[model samples]
Target: MEERKARTVCCIGDVHGYISKLQSLWSNLESCIPRLDFDSALIIFLGDYCDRGPDTRLVIDFLVSLPFRYPRQKHVFLSGNHDFAFAAFLGAIPQPQDGSEFREGWKEYEMSEEREGWYREEGYQGMHLQGRRWAGKITVRFNTIKGTEYQGSIYDAEPTFKSYGVPHGSSDLLRAVPEEHKKFLTDLVWVHEEDNVCIETSDGVKTGRLIAVHAGLQKGKKVEEQLSSLKAKDTRIPKVEALSGRKSVWDIPEELTEPPTIVVSGHHGKLHIDGLRLIIDEGGGLENNPVAAIILPGLKIVRDTDPLVKQ
Candidate 1:
């Protein structure tokens, strides 16, 4: 009997609308890996495809074309927090299953509305809180956290707006965004899982189940409960911690350890690899940073700014 070969999996980090970097990284990946492996590879893009940098429109176009361009490669696009808010503003997210209005979600964060300058434009009535905040203008000029000027809104979505040929905070963006682009945003998944994935550890290569989320699973929560909500794309909860959390979601759940599950994420703005946990967002959408990707089995990292190709 012959043993089956391991499949190659490539997990890409946050793009943040950098078209050139994404293109370079894509080229680099193809150049680094063997042609057959690259063609049939499972490419998982940990999301944040828009905002911060310029060329979001082009980035979406490139992503949308991947299926047609490489029919053999498997592609999985996970929704980032920025994308969720983008979809919300575009009225792309589905209505809550419980028959509650999207406005109901605003109450929890309503105190910050005025301060955040929540969008009260043409269609704010039925919009979600994140949508309002995404399109809203901020009162402050500087973003203390990122150490940069606030880019039109709290989400730094000015570039996204401009990419569609609209001015910052203009309600005209509703009509400006193309239908395909809207579809791309609407079709984004909250979470994805793969079985029998091979990961390289310092000790040796290990096979396990892998869970890819935009942020990560909370440390103490039941994995099933969290996955249920994520799978349902539950919008009732104002903030999906799994999609946009900080330290609380830094670690993998204890239950997953028994089965040797690998937890990977990209919303934390840093590259962290400890044992089976991988957080691969080196770019964080910053202009100076380079977009990154991690190739499985070998656990090698490929970046947009890498010199030419690997030796």
Candidate 2:
């Protein structure tokens, strides 16, 4: 019996609206991998597709065109914290099944509303907390942690508004965003699971289940419960921990250890690979950093600034 070739799987990190970097990285991936393999590869995009950079509109357009451009390739788009807020502001998130108002979820973060300048414009009455925050104006101009000047809001979402031809905090953004872009945001998944995924290791090639989320799964929680909440897109919770958590979600859940699942994510703003766990967000949406991607089986790392392709 002829042995089947292992399929190529590429997991791309946070783009944060840098169209040029994304284009360069895509070209580099093409140049580095064989054409036949690249065409049929499974491409998983770890989100944060909007904000921070100036080309969000173009970036979304590029992502939307991928399926048509590369018909043979399979693509999976996961929602990141930034993207979740973006979708919230666009009213793209599905309403809670319980029928509670989105504003009801704002109680926990209400204290920060005044300081963050949460959006209270024309259509803010029923807005989600993250949506208001995303479109809000912050009094402070600098971010101590990121060491970058605030781009109109704490989410640094001013660039996203500008990319759509609207001024920051303006309700005009409600209409400025295109329908296709809105659909793309609405369709983003919070969690993606793949069975029998092949990955390279020091020992050898191994096949196992793969779980891809934005930030990561919390370490101590029940994997099934967390997966349920994410799959339901429960907007009742003020914040989706898996998409925005920091240290809490840095490790894989103990439950998946028995079966040896590969957990991958891209929201930590750094590249880390340990055993079957991978964190691929090397760019962190900073102007100076380059976007990154990880090719499975071979476990090869590719960056936008690699200079692998000819100019």
Candidate 3:
């Protein structure tokens, strides 16, 4: 049976460890609350919990403690690709040379059925992200003569992950991640695709649908069909005619042959679709960008909110 959910839900977007920002949001929410009363409330954290900001570790520590600290509160922390890699490193999977930060994030949150169960009910296998397989084709790839790629040849996979830039190449920071975590990350890069959350929410006085995602859905196919295409385990490159039925996250042919259901994604940071009512990603980890989140279970009745993380 699908687990029962609280009537009121608060959806948080990509929080790239902006400790101060998080604190600010938390404090503000207190004031934001008391404006309504429901049988219960669920606070859903749309993934992308770390990276691109200062104190990624600190941010994770704070977030992981919420469940235990709050008790009985309806909370769901979805796993972002980065969250998986960092947590795996902490658990020492695919063991990396350094596992300190990953360890910190891992230890920060308890691995409970409650946490994993949250996403399972959501119908996203993000929790098993570490177990996702990529034998056929890879959307993104990496080729650098850096630490891992000794062969030094062009290799294709997903983008691997985002580079925070500012203090690029933090060997100490990178190395702190355990080997297993590195492998998980490597695998994640090999199969990066458009990932997002589909939520159901309601505004104050009306009912509506909304999608909060990191990128926009391909123009051609409907959102539901496009989602089915992504769910494919055998992502074989479709023939041109067959491709007509598929959908891509970002970087799809602008001239879409099919129009899928609407997707609200955040990967490109800010892109939109009309029919889908695609909302732009409030830039996180980007300079001068406002931290953001999407509230749900209100009256507007949003269907999903997906936080996009780079491969």
TM-score of each: 0.97, 0.97, 0.45
* Model 3 Cα lDDT, one tens digit per residue, 269-301: 443334334443465345456555544433232
lDDT of 2 by residue, 129-211 (tens): 89999999998888999888999998899999999999999999989999999999999999999876888777678788899
Give model 2's clash tally: 0
Question: Which residue pairs show collisions in model 1?
Answer: none
Task: Give the least accurate 10-residue stretch of model 3, judged by summed lDDT.
Answer: 150-159
Tens digit per residue, CA lDDT, model 1, 1-311: 11235789999999999999999999999999999999999999999999999999999999999999999999999999999999999998888999999899899999998889999989999998889999999999998888999898999999999999999889999999989989999999999999878877666677778999999999888899999999999999888899899998999888988877889999999999988899999999999999999999888999999997643
TM-score of 1: 0.97
Model 2 earns a TM-score of 0.97
lDDT of each model, Cα atoms only?
A: 0.92, 0.92, 0.38
C-alpha displacement of 184 in model 2, angstroms?
0.5
State each model's C-alpha RMSD to the native: 2.0, 2.0, 14.7
Q: How accurate locally is residue 20 in candidate 3, as Cα lDDT from 0 to 100?
A: 73
